[model samples]
Target: MMAMTQLQSGDRAKIVDLSRVSELVRRRLLDMGVTEGVEVCLKCTMPLGGPFMIESCGQCLGIRRSEAMRIQVERV
Candidate 1:
């Protein structure tokens, strides 16, 4: 397993788990399609520390670094 930040842009991976920091945050991610076993692709990371986007289930969603660190993934 690898942290989401370690993946390069365009890399595809399966979500493993979300950190236990916040239940609401985790639930929100799940609601937005970042569930365990779901495949997702890193789209792009903004320069200057902005949010990054991930493509999953035919949808692209942007998430901040703080939120992303909670996610663990494995290459697909």
Candidate 2:
């Protein structure tokens, strides 16, 4: 498993786990449909290694590199 942030643009992955981010952050992410076993696609990344855009559950989400690093996923 690797961080979702490590995935290349257009890569698809299945979320397996999430690191110990803050409880509120975790809840927020989960509320946005980023739970385990869900599949996500890396739609885009900022030019300077900033936030990443991911598609999941028919929704697009923007997350920071630090946040993405807590989301563990396996390539699909």
For each candidate, give its TM-score against the true structure. 0.88, 0.88
Which residue pairs in candidate 1 collide?
none
Q: Candidate 1, residues 1-76: lDDT per residue as tens digits? A: 9888899999999999876437887777788977889999999999887888999999998888777777899998
lDDT of 1: 0.85
Q: List, residue by residue over 1-76, the lDDT tens digit for candidate 2.
A: 9888789999999999876556777788789978889999999998786899999988998878888888889999
- In order, candidate lDDTs are 0.85, 0.87
How far out, in Å, is residue 48 in model 2? 2.1
Model number with the top lDDT = 2
- Model 1 steric clash total: 0
- Residue 21 lDDT in candidate 2: 58
The true-versus-predicted C-alpha distance at residue 5 of model 2, in Å, is 1.9
Task: Give the per-residue Cα lDDT of candidate 1 at 17.
Answer: 84
**What C-alpha root-mean-square deviation, in Å, does candidate 1 show against the real structure?**
1.4
